[model samples]
Target chain A: MAAGKPVVMVTLVSSDGQSFQLLEEAALLSAMVRDTIQIGQGRGPAGIPIRNITGQTLSMVVVYCNKHYTAAAAADGDDAADEEKKVANKKQLREWDEQFINLEQDKLYDILVAANNLGIDGLVDLCCWRFADMMKGKSASEIRVKLGIRDDFTSEQRAQIEKDSPWVWSRTT
Target chain B: MLQPARENEGVWRLSVWCFGVDAGVQFSRCENPIFPLIPSMAQDGGESRDWAEMPSDALSGVFGKLNASDILTGAGLVCRVWRQLATNDPTLWRRVDMSCQADLVENMKAKYAMARIAVNRAAGTMEAFSAEYFVTDDLLLYISTRASSLKSLHLIYCPYISIKGIAEAMKGFTQLEELTLYLSSFHGYVSEAIGRAGQQLICFRLNNAFGYYNCPVDDTEAFWIANNMPELRELQLIGNRLSNDGLIAILDHCLRLESLDVSRCYNVQMDDVLKSKCARIRDLMLPRDQDVFIDSDPSDEGYSYDTDAMYDSEY
Candidate 1:
């Protein structure tokens, strides 16, 4: 609708009662918000209220959508038909993605939760990869320390678990 | 407009490449209405998100990316929740590799019991299962029943596993492709079953050539393989005692065989006639023709004598 018409801005109300404005197309990048927009048929004057997201997280999600849409449009162009150029474009997008996700631990998780709430498949996967990478070579205790979680199991229960599956006990690597 | 858009562009652009294509999709969202979404100031004594608080499915996704041992031993015993999830999650147990510890004879019962838990979690989705020790008839019976979709099976040092048990198990694994039975004593019952059912087998490694008692694999085993596994594309038989006759039979019978490793099998000579006869095989590794000799260090013997005479020279 924005091809010749003036750019329409959709107001997004985050959980903390703050409002952020975004281009309609950029807001539609999130599957949940896109559905809300489609349901409103561009007529919801009150704006869509994201009940679980904060102002900062919503802003980040908007920025992600706008950037990804641009990359996706570029990658879908005619030159992308060539396998090598398409791969290069994907690699470029991935490198940009790497930089985007390089936030602090809690911030990354926050973005992950926000992405999931917004129904952003791409962002969810990125956060999951970072999450997995953090746990890859780390011991359970190390993962606990890094992620700021406490060891909830008692020594008795831990010993029992070790008894049940002693394989984990013997593995040093 | 362009400069601002470029900067904003960096804020977005997350893709599946960050994680693997399959994993890190989503955890069932647990929205704690009281847990404020805003990051609290450091002075407010604020609580941040806990790592262990991710959804069970999302946590399973992380465990799914880890190796089996890492999942079972490293992640499984972390805490009650992780232990339960690791024990119960099917995705983490699909490809069980017990080729290392946990397969020792002493821990055979416990580990095999643990293996049952894994295969049970895996349901029918199990693809590859391998163990370096004691794959008894009982384990095969349990696995064959559970992991019906199994494709690759490697059981090394399972001298206790009867050929009949494995052969019976092989009947269910019609999708079987890669099979490795290493460091085991001789048996021929598997040949009949493999020939009948394992038509899809692409790689076969029978390192029965290794011996606890140095009893090498003879022409009997070779002839059984020649008669049975004609569909094999790759084969390895280290420490085999197969003679020229068995090799000749194999080359003639297994016409589709592309890669063969008969290393340490001194009896089968790769003469010109034999080489030309088996010219179609691309990645063939035959036993070396001559024993590779290293030059003896004659000077080293004189050095010891020179050291002994040092006391005389000092006097």
Candidate 2:
């Protein structure tokens, strides 16, 4: 839609004093960004400072938002009028999201936290789905090990949980 | 269109990166930027940023993706915070669905216990409930006492729950809006109780076993629904033996009904007069409609809703 119009650019400053610039539409993927821009709070001489998010994490978030926004724009393009083409576009985007989210646990955690702080609903859902997948079909101990969770429950606590719902401990399979 | 850097932008330089497939996607310069200063969930656990201590909002997101079994066993057992959320969070237990757990069916006693645990977790604020195979009279009574705020109840293939149990249970569910009973047999008293109590009911689905030999040409269930449920917007009597007379009764009483599904109910003739009578319904599914039972069962694998002895017809 903005093919001929001048692109509005927004500058974002990461926690470690790193500044990145992106198209305004793409930056609006983050609700925080949309709210800030709507309130005219981020029209400073320097870019809006993103506290807590490191330069590395902020850059990844920017890449994700830009990729998704571009894909969304393409889907909304006139050529994507056909239902089949729209489905194909969605499939391709899903594939790309899968690849993009294939990060190490620490990186995944950072992205999840960053997504939540920025009020990025889609990114938060993606991250949560990934975590759910990791926990699926695995026992509590297995999940604790996989997700680096400590076994803090006492023997009594564990027994009480098991007692409350024995079906949960036993494999339905 | 590279604009000259303003005086305040002396230290910052914009670099254009070519993002995959889409070339020359610029990530630079907007008039307004977002300054997100909110502390992350990780910060709640102090500097270590422990995964176990992640806040409830993010944890609930993950919980939303998990099934009943996963929540009860896996996440609830993970850590203290996770356990707290799993056991105490009324929002999580508000709409408990314990159906479609094929593996859990083998141990009926344990499954029943698990269902009770889930209900208890709701802490009497449950709004919607769905379950199959393992429900009993005691359990239904338990739910009735606790979940008076329940709005939707879907029970599938619950052989152990008696007709008296359902009747007694309906007394507590005065605010119920949607109810689905699949393969669960119930007669006059249960229907009367539901009709009396479920004044706010908008949708009622009573699906029996399918097949030609299964027909008994009964209309008692249909008449009860027609006389009692005036607010019904959707009614599905799939594989019922109710004839044209019953259908007419339902049409006469349930004036507000927009959808009616009598698929596989061979007893109903659907004559031109009856057809014209039902023309007002936006979605009318006739007996010959193919695959009407597609959305019949819950998303569980092992337990299919098809049971040969589901309806006696003799009654």
Candidate 3:
């Protein structure tokens, strides 16, 4: 986005038939949305249909994009005290990001998929990290409970696996 | 590991689909939770083309970050779908980090057996391996047979990794570029053997790997490094016994050295000429002079606290 150029507002319609307006720069944080908006260049103010993402999910993702885009711009700004400020800004954003993805399990799942669909890299990584945190230091039963996976292993099969790699299984932590 | 009926059923592949280039994909009520659960518009008879149920590529990325033990022991045993995705890949076992094991001496054989699972799974695509805690001659020899494409081998905290095992194993790792050793000392002809073997060696850091190990990295090791490894870039020899002669040998020979860490190399004499030469290096961690800090334990400032609210110092 160039200076003094009039910023176009893009209308994004989520799957549940909800409309949300966004600044072109913030909206363009997603490559998918950016491309969709660009394809309708000069035709008119076209409302791009987000068939994949829900209204609630898309809004959260938009919030994430706006925060990240602003932080990135500030970090890439001028010299002298710039490096110190940039690091501080990055740290602040990281803290904010951690807070942002502190939703419940189901919501986080939705966000992960939504982020993937929108092709937003930062949001995806954040969501992935959040999910990975849940997986960490968890037992096999605990992991299965969280990930909604079924324990289809037979007793005989379990015993064999236990015998084969006892040390790995022994790491309860 | 439960062998999947089909070889590559749920194998996750990274899709490099460019945005806007192919904006043809539409969303539907995906049964798999990892995808968008939009009600299908323009409905088709066939099941959704998300053939793996969820986005397999995303799943791959998640699994890739997990350690060898985590995947093999916990995640792989979770469900049938996960088991297939986790176990049925050779490249996934490229990094076998068994350093996480605490009481290695207790279940040494079992731990090594788990390591062997990864080595066997790797099937020669073992690119980077970092083993620690406990490693024996037999284990090293076993790794040598399997891991041919091994690039980075870090035996950081593995004091038990003997010269014979590592030197003998070096024959297999002809393609090894980044070699890091800390507790495991290279005396005898092992250093010479490493010199002879590692032609493509780039980053060699025998840094005692931030460990409390007082093992000395001497001039004999430096001589071997100088003799071999012409393409070295980043070299860290902490607690090194390299004198003026050995230091000069490195400066004269390895001209492409960009990052040099001789933090504990107190004997390495640095005069004006050598100082000027070292100044040219992009990243340099010169030998810590005594005048900087009058503390006995230089590494710590009593920052970290252990369990039970007690301040723990390495010193």
Candidate 4:
């Protein structure tokens, strides 16, 4: 509620007792966060209890929001120094995003679940696209084992599937 | 037990021996460690095999992410379940581009019809349709009826499409945004029909086919487009008969114009007409042979023609 501070702020509490505070402008990037802020009075400090997200995931989300918020603020300023600094900041943020999403399979799956539950569109898209990219050049069986999927086919059904797509079985790599 | 010893006893003994040989005999019994583990290994192998097949929904999700070529060659024909899942995903058929194969128009039509049916059943609507060749007027009408949600239509090398067909098709598509027509033989009538359709067209591309048979500079289609389509942002006229007047009209009308390509247009002097008329034009494509001259003489008509000067300055 201070004069220089953001008009709205959201307090996100992860399952591990860690809290992430974000400015309204940054939170508005997510429709869910914007709607939540709209429902509550924009004046008071509010805490959003996120049951699904963990400390690690919540930290990553906050980092993304903070970077975007600073970039947006710098873009709004008319000063040449601010504009030049913001362009350099944006390039650095892009590199950070590329590195931030390079997580292991198990961590990636957890992040995907957290992002989906938190209604983070950008994060969800990044995770899904990464998963889809991993699926390339992999056979059906390899994909099943890698993704931890159970085979629900009968012996007759398995034979039929193999008969329908012999390429899936005959692929070398 | 001892029996009476006689010549008949020997014969009876031999008969008993023959009977014993005919019956099954038993050897020494022993245990092998490797044989005991075979059953368990086979059972483990079966368990791993069972873990290979994935759930149907997950398979569908993976298939939905594949591109069109992969969907056709790999996912659609994988299995009954995969085929069902791949066919069910609507995003797979959002944009159907058959512009690359003009020679196999009939085959492409058949494939498109089948794709339309599948997409309709799965997604409930087909949003866009693009084709290289327009063989019959009826085909265009049919496409218009089937793809009701169609927004973008690209036609290339298809001269058979008349103004009437375009008018009929444009009537249904109120949300049409981008239209790219290449080698179209339609003239002023088609441009008029497009203007009447009342849809906000953003991009219009017309190639050599829109020009006159010999003297392309005589074609007035460019003027018609400049006067009518006010929402035009990008315009490309290749091998057309666009003059300085037509270029001026376009520059005056399309205020939001970003990119313009007017290659092989002999009539319009680039530096004299374009640069003076539209100052905001960023991306411009001009023919290589023509030299832009900048004429400063007030008495002569070429004085206003600063084509050569502007060309030299830019280079």
Task: List model 2 lDDT by residue over A1-173, tens digit each.
Answer: 45697888898887767788888889899999999999987756686889988776788799888899998888777474598888888899899889888764555777888899899999999988887876777778767655556778877886887677666555411
Better of 1 and 4 by lDDT: 1
Off by over 4 Å in 4: A1-49, A53-85, A135-173, B1-142, B155-174, B182-200, B208-216, B223-231, B243-259, B270-284, B289-315
Of the true interface contacts, what fraction does each candidate have?
Answer: 0.28, 0.47, 0.24, 0.04
For B1-315, candidate 3 gives per-residue lDDT tens digits of 011122221221111031222212222234333344433321221223331245665566666767887777676666666667776777679887777567657866767787788888888889888877667778878888888798888875676776777778888887888888865454454456674565788988876422221333357767777778788999987756677678777877888889888875666657987888787689988776322433355335452224222112211
Please give the ranking of all candidate structures by DockQ, highest first, separated by commas.
2, 1, 3, 4
Give the clashing residue pairs of candidate 2, or none: A9-B29, A9-B30, A10-B29, A10-B30, A21-B27, A21-B28, A22-B27, A22-B28, B100-B300
What DockQ, on C-alphas, does every prediction get?
0.20, 0.24, 0.13, 0.04
Model 3 off-target regions past 4 Å? A1-3, A38-46, A75-81, A154-164, A168-173, B1-53, B89-91, B100-104, B186-189, B207-218, B263-267, B270-315
Question: Docking quality tier of candidate 4?
Answer: incorrect
Tens digits of lDDT, candidate 2, B1-315: 122223322211211111221111111122112312312212211122357877578888888788766787788788888898887777778888888877755778876776787778888888998998889989998998889999999999888887788888998897899999888665543466574765678999877656342345778878888888999999988777789999999999998999999887877887898989998999989987855445443234533334345554424
lDDT of 2 at B293: 48
Best-fitting candidate, scored by lDDT: 2
> In each prediction, how many residue pairs overlap at the backbone (N, C-alpha, C within less than 3 A)?
2, 9, 0, 11
lDDT of 3 at B220: 76
